[model samples]
Target: MKNASPAQMLLGLRIHAAAFVATIIVLFAVNVMVGPPYWVGWVLLGWCIGLISHWWSVRYHTSHRTDPN
Candidate 1:
């Protein structure tokens, strides 16, 4: 598949971040209801790493991109 444009990559990152936040909220609610070991923290940490990696990847690509002109 062709590579996405920088704008597309950024948009994808935003969508991923939004979904991550929404999912984390639901997970936190569930964890609270369960009243136990609180596993949502682990999920948040792991997903945060992934999200940061995604953001870094986008930033690197966009900053390094050469204009086609």
Candidate 2:
């Protein structure tokens, strides 16, 4: 994965973020339909934490990457 181009890595991260958003939306709808649950929020929180970490790592590496010169 380290050999992946910056564009490729960014696209992968974006796809992951999109998946997280979709999952959260579905979970929220399910919660509303079921009249509340203790797990949806936790699931969203956990996924969000992971998503944030991924986003940060991508951003950090993208910014820090040195030009081949």
Candidate 3:
């Protein structure tokens, strides 16, 4: 069986979580910045849902992803 190094696994997970959160934040900000096209709202909502799902899956194993700054 192939075994993953702990550091490699942690880095892989953090990368995915970061991407998920980044997408949500970017889309949400864009929605807020650009007033109602309406569909933008839906896109943001979808991103939020995806972010939530990502968090739920990884919370126990990898609670904190990035620095505040």
Best by TM-score: 1
Q: Write the per-residue lDDT of candidate 2 for residues 1-69, one digit (tens) a residue.
A: 566778988998999999998989998888888884457989988998999998888888888888887
The segments of candidate 1 whose C-alpha lies over 4 angstroms from its true place after superposition are: none
lDDT, candidates in the order shown:
0.92, 0.85, 0.61
| Candidate no. 2 TM-score | 0.85
Model 1 TM-score relative to the real fold: 0.93
Q: For candidate 3, report its TM-score.
A: 0.44
For residues 3-66, could you state the per-residue lDDT of candidate 3 as single tens digits? Answer: 4444655666677668866876787677778867646666657766876675465554444444
Residue pair clashes in candidate 3: none
The prediction achieving the highest lDDT against the true structure is 1
Model 1: lowest-lDDT 10 consecutive positions: 1-10
- Each prediction's number of clashing residue pairs: 0, 0, 0
The ten-residue window of minimal lDDT in model 3 covers 1-10
In Å, residue 15's CA in model 2 sits off its true spot by 0.2
Q: Which candidate do you rate higher for lDDT, 1 or 3?
A: 1
